[model samples]
Target: MQTWDVIVIGAGPVGENVAERVVASGLSAVIIEAELVGGECSYWACMPSKALLRSGHARRAAAHVRGTGVHEPTGPGAGPDVAEVLARRTSFTSGWDDSGQVEWLQGVGVDLIRGHGRLAGDRVVEVSTANGTDRLQARCAVVVCTGSDAHVPDALAAVSPWTSREATSVEEVPGRLAIVGGGVVGTEMATAYRDLGADVTMLVRGQVLAGQEPFAGELVTASLTERGVDVRAGVTVVSATRDGGPSTPVRLTCDDGQVVEADEVLVATGRRPRTDDLGLSIVGLTDGQWLDVDDTLRVQGAQWLYAVGDVNHRALLTHQGKYQARAAGDVIVARARGTEVLAGQWQRHAATADHRSVPQVVFTDPEVASVGLTAAVAREAGHAVRVVDYDLGAVAGAALHADGYGGRARMVVDTDRQVLLGVTFVGPDVAELLHAATVAVVGEVPIERLWHAVPAYPTISEVWLRLLETFGREG
Candidate 1:
């Protein structure tokens, strides 16, 4: 019965950005959310997880320095106060409340429908609310920003293993926690729970941080091991059994007939699109499938429909999803107003970075920060590439930052173009060093020109200078 210029199916950061952008461009927008308006990143994934990890990072950083009077705890109990850390994590999520997010939505003049929204054909969204079902129409575009959900293997389903949602929002640290998968979520939770005084075991089917540079996994694996985490790589959980209810311990049987017992188990394997019940079949798209989108984020074969964020499977990170949202929103507006829709690569209305220049940071101890392509990827893309490596500890700033600082920096250069195609930094607090690398790679800054962008002395950022030095300006 009602209509808006745009209808966003989810109110996560990606949906919020798209709605905000469209509303700012003079299009009326409405967001339909079944849960918290702030979505997973705000309540469960990004904010709370980082909050849980930060205190541990600070504690370790202080302990590493000589005059701080802090030392590594002999046992987990000696680390950061668990109660205070959990409370702080809760505070970051506003105690899992979304009133502030709702207020912001209202302030921006975007309407909200609190319900489940599903496609019912072109430009029509049927929302199921507590009162009843209401059919709404979109005058301009229908954007699906439904995001994603954690994929739990069928074998582990009955055991009620924790996902990223449960892991980040847990009120109590388990006495013994077992984590499966060595990707970002698994590694991060392993780091956090270990620091929070839990006996942690990681059963990884592959190397940790496998998507990043191999050295990243090696360094993180070393750090976690030194910190008392039992990391078993190339190990798979064949089955899981929890005999009782929530209070029971979980028993995991591995492929090698080894059994691991834990107070809690977390599965961080992967994510799948949240399109199962969105009525996509009515619109000719399959349910529970990742939507395909063009560079402009328009759904393939559907002119008026757009899919952004994790739903499109292009850069599942929250920040990257927001980046795609911005482009999608602008392009939708342009098309609506009969203006120029700049769809060229790297244009104002294109999400080119999703393919060529995405940046990611894993907040484990000795954080992993990377942007653009890895060396292997660049070569596979058929670029004549040269990889430059530098010992981050050799940089004066890194040494000054922490005693016995250990880390590595790598830059993959396109030899034919003499520009950086990728940069990876694995070390303590190297996350802050990522943006400059992102700019250089995204801007396609030539190595010759980078020589003039001198890094200031005595900071982890000076790794840039060291990396360039290792690469040699002329070469």
Candidate 2:
């Protein structure tokens, strides 16, 4: 039996952050991982997905500019060499290896156990390794950071549809790819495969990028259409089946009685917590359910148990998960040493941003970047809100960035407080403009004070100035 100050299940980015933070605060920590130490984002989701999309984005950006001798590929064998792109993507994942990640953990004084970990009881984790079973105990806390898994509906199960994992790590681009769902994953893979020369079709039950500002999805839909994707909105797949072997094409029958065939089908509908087999029943929590946590990330009714990251269902993005991990780790340290815990909103030991100021970027052709509440959400939250819109294409920097720059920017302000509640940008390279907006929203900077934070000339960031101008100086 081994013991540590903290035991973290799953060595993903979220787990790594928690373990590292706790160790740095004079506590011993150990991470137990069943797969790669770096988890989903490092190997399957974020790194590889972004790597696959970046080549296409660069190609399009260069093709849009007048000079630099870049042109759209003309022949059947033209466009980005798919082999090279996959190679680059693989490199980012270190060929799906986690040796470096393991080394980093060791360097930071965090021990690791290569196995499956489950809660045996309060602060007790039973790890099943190749050798045998070992019981490890945490003197302070046991944190669940197992993250999430892609969800494929039962109707599509027979078709063996690809999830985000398979899509990002695919070796070869399909001749035809059908994507169901128009959220971030579906839209991104559609862009990547289309740019790699696949005949892409998207069947979306509702608008793409549904939770974001409607205009963002509208613009992304337009861009995807112009780039030769067949986007069918308001379409639902009633059933899907593959007739033959793994190489066989998939047949999708839609609710509208439209049948679609594709060499590959990717279902990017949603995610569910990976908690079914973690022995939650031993701790009085249900299996296969999201673990509920307070602002400090402590599992409700369980003082020695904590759930961070996607397992808590509070902001599923990797960055947000890490943010929660930092707070959770620090607060655990404070509690263990009998020190003061600043648990107030926006305090050092609180994850307030998960509710009020989360920032997200979708790496599609015209990237979608947003932070904080949407205008509708702010109003629904009982805030008197004002929405300001600006034409991103008209911004001088946007015009200079690309010849046919086209996009939009929106700011949702709390009229009663005269502070920004949210900001959304939909355009090429607008992702670079998000942090400034995130700071403003998270800091709750007054509208008048923002006037002094001038943006540099002729950059996409100039949209900030334009947004403030549209909002006006007066109440």
lDDT of 2 by residue, 1-475 (tens): 7999999999999999999999999999999999999999999999999999998899879988998689876555577889999999999999989999999999999999999999998789999999999999899999999999999999898877899999999998899999999999999999999988899999999999999999989999999998789999999999988889678999999999999999999999999999988999877889899999999999998999999999999999999999999999999999999999999989999999999799999999899999999998888899999999999999999899999899999999998899999999999998988999999999999999999998889788888888888888534
lDDT of 1 at 351: 96
Candidates' TM-scores?
0.99, 0.98
Against the unseen true structure, what C-alpha lDDT does each candidate score?
A: 0.93, 0.94
lDDT of 1 at 438: 98
Tens-digit lDDT string for candidate 1 (211-248): 99999999999999998999999988999998888789
Against the true structure, candidate 2 reaches a TM-score of 0.98
The lDDT of model 1 is 0.93
State the displacement of the C-alpha of residue 73, model 2, in Å, after optimal TM-score superposition. Answer: 3.5
Model 2 weakest 10-residue run by lDDT: 72-81
True-structure lDDT of candidate 2: 0.94
- Quote the lDDT for 91 in model 2: 98
